[model samples]
Target: MPRLLWPLLGLLLLAGCASNKERPELTEVDQYREASESLESRNYLTAIDQLKELEARFPYGDFAEQAALDLIYAQYRAVDYPATVVAAQRFMRNYPAHPRMDYALYMRGLANFNMEKGLFDNMVSSDKSSKDMGAAKDAFRDFERLVNRFPDSEYAPDARSRMVHIRNQLARQELHVARYYARRGAIIASINRAQYVVKHYQQTPAVPEALAIMAKGYQRLKQPELAEKSRDVLALNWPDSKFLDNDKQVDLAWWPDEDDGLLSLLTFDLL
Candidate 1:
């Protein structure tokens, strides 16, 4: 009688435990699906709210991770740089080993890239305050990390292309400032800027222009030997460069002397 009573008691406890266990809620799933649909339709604000709510309610759950990633994307698409950075940082912290970690890092970089100053805007220092290019540099560094860590990622190619574009823009801005100084009769300032462009961005299209400016600036300072050397390099690399026409008459002063040889050949023809 005692053994039979103990077995009945155990069965009753098991039944109670089973009855107390709650079933998984479908509300979060429903909300996530609706928010995803809204995001697909370009209703980013609504999607962001829904994703945020889902994450707050389901924190530490699988859907929470998904919500965080979606929130980052929605913020990115809406051009909310600050929010995007926050979301990306949070996603990295929560899902450190996630397969999409590369994407989050890349997007973080892009958020800062969008905030970078324009090339022409940077040149107008008197009108506009000087801009900090640190953000652009950071963006490039992040993209480089993505490339190095995930070389086979689909985003690597575009990241590389954007880096080149940003570098070229920076180089072009420096060249523009150098020309501005040269035009203002600030020979030393112009030479300094031009030399910086040559040293830092030798591969850019602005290199030829920078070289021409450096030559012209040196010539103005009465450094004819250095001016001639720069001209020789410019002629060898970009004979038809448009920058050669920047200072129309001034460039002729540095042009190599071919008149003597031409006259000698013509004299021989006359003979």
Candidate 2:
């Protein structure tokens, strides 16, 4: 061979060797099987990587939908809640009429449900009611949508039960704000918030406190008739309520403390 041709031949042989050593691309089924093995082994992070690669490689393949579902679960198992939520939402949007739509909804709600309890938050023992309820509200809406759309879905019963708990939490959240306002002497704001808990969150434990707030607020505003009405309702429905005094009137303790304390100043005595 000519001198220039010899060098070119050597380069060609090296390229051939490299090509021979290259691994073959995985088939859709192979990728999915690998991902499933990772999941079964509880190697969720590995499964997440494999499932995502499977999705990217076979976006429109036969196993695409299943890969998407598996990715959602893998991310969830890995504690990647935000990613799980996004993957679940994508699945729902892509497969709106899929038979397992309810499952997707349930997972999305569950992801958001646990999103509030990140690692650091879980370490501390804090009151759930006192924490920000944004994620909880989002979770409630998702569960509600699931139950409404798939009343007979296998997940419906659990969704319904979660909704009841969420409702109670939301009621307490509102009452907490109402109490804060009451302590600040923002009587009208307190009354409005309390009424919201009563009207929208009926049957919740917060109702008795809400009634007590309303009755006291009315009395402070010099609306004797409205105060009497609110007091009567509290007496009738929650006779054993802690807010009721021996005389069956709204307990004086239910109202804000008269002393202008540091907490009142810090909270600005306003809602």
Number of clashes recorded per candidate: 0, 0
The local lDDT score (0 to 100) that residue 95 gets in candidate 1 is 88
Per-residue accuracy of model 2 over 1-271 as CA lDDT, tens digit each: 5989999999999999998896788999998999999999999999989988988888999999998898899899889999999999999999989999999999999998888785677678655776699988999999999999999999999998998988898899898888878787678999999999989999999899899999988988899999999999999998988999889989957466545433575668542
CA lDDT scores, all candidates in order: 0.77, 0.88
Q: What is the lDDT of residue 78 in candidate 2?
A: 87
Inter-residue clash pairs, candidate 2: none
Clashes of 2: 0
Can you tell me which runs of candidate 1 are displaced by over 4 Å? 1-26, 116-135, 245-271
How far is 259's C-alpha from truth in model 2 (Å)? 5.7
Estimate the TM-score of every prediction: 0.70, 0.87
